[model samples]
Target: MNPNPLKILVLYYSQHGGTQNLARQIARGIESVAGCEAVLRTVPKVSAVCEAVESDIPAAGAPYCSAEDLKTCAALALGSPTRFGNMAAAMKYFLDGTVAQWLGGELIGKPATVFTSAGSLHGGQESTLLTMMLPLLHHGMIISGVPFSEAALGQTRSGGTPYGASHMAGAEGRPELSSHEQQTAFAQGRRLAELAVKLAV
Candidate 1:
């Protein structure tokens, strides 16, 4: 008999493609684990106008995430570009709508992690990652961060922290991830997947 692979949700919102790249790296890490699959998803852009809207399907990139995706994911990795030391409004908007899942305890006990991209070295990367956990905490998801054993967290000059994987995407726009950033993200993903397997058992 064959068993189903565990699904780990990779969800994020990116404006200049920086955060999205981090999401992809995290997904690669999650998929590296045997019996685990990464389900990459994104949220639609938000608008201040009450009636402003976007197409249900994005013109490019990952499909928008749904409540069902959250319900079914064995684990989750949330990413977003930093906005004044916090999660971007688009990602925040998505999390704000998860009350149904919270009420049903759909995410309780599942493992989760977060990632971010910022224009400057000190551009709230850690703060954004920290704040991103609030909604997951409300959902009762088990949260984990990069361990010191992941040496990249200590050696990275670009972007990396014990809080989560991060990228220092500078003023030019999205640039290739630094080696440390990539390694840290992959490490985080692997860690999350490993914990998910243990928890599921």
Candidate 2:
């Protein structure tokens, strides 16, 4: 690892692992760039009851994201499983709590990207991705998406979109990604990292 590599934070909320799978592919793409490192973090589940409390650390998967992660990262990639044509409440909850970072301009000008997974092909993946970008835009982040130049964008029959990388997990909420979905995700990550490197310079 480069001692002072550029850090690209990959933050997400996954209910059935589909979004998490997409996040891993994006992280791989980010790490492919020299002097760039991917930091994977996740938001804890939100409960309907206000009294419900989650453990400090998750039982599995990436650890919870911290304010320091937002402050220090050179770039960001956010993902979430789709819910009613929007991002999961857990992710929305996490972003809602970042008012301090917004006030401090912590993420301003950083390159950012969004991704999502839905149970059906038309199950609001694009809408979910768009909803995830709202907070990033409020923070003054530069958002990137999968360009049509990526061959997978044209080839994907299931989940690839110009809005961002996405996956169709079917009703079962499977985690496995289609080949095109993976390719588009990797391309999106690499693009974000490359942009971050250039902007950092």
Question: Best candidate, lDDT-wise?
Answer: 2
Worst 10 residues of 2 by lDDT: 47-56
Model 2 residue runs over 4 Å out of place are: none
Task: Summarize candidate 2's per-residue lDDT along 1-201 as a digit string, tens digits.
Answer: 689999999998998888899999999999999999999999988876632767888999999999999999999999998899999888888999999999999999999999999999999988888888888999999999988999998888889899999999998878999999999999999999999999999
Which numbered prediction scores highest in TM-score against the true structure?
A: 2
Give the lDDT of residue 89 in candidate 2: 86
Question: How far in Å is the alpha carbon of 18 misplaced in model 2?
Answer: 0.8
For each of the candidates, the C-alpha root-mean-square deviation to the true structure, in angstroms, is: 1.5, 1.1
Q: Write the per-residue lDDT of candidate 1 for residues 1-201, one digit (tens) a residue.
A: 118999999998988887888888898998889989999999988886622667878999999998889999999999999999999988898899888898999999999999999999999998899999999999999999999999888888999989999999889876579999999999999999999999989
Where does model 1 exceed 4 Å of error?
1-3, 49-51
Full-model lDDT, candidate 1:
0.91
List TM-scores for all candidates, in order: 0.96, 0.97
- Against the true structure, candidate 2 reaches a TM-score of 0.97
188 in model 2: Cα distance from truth in Å? 0.7
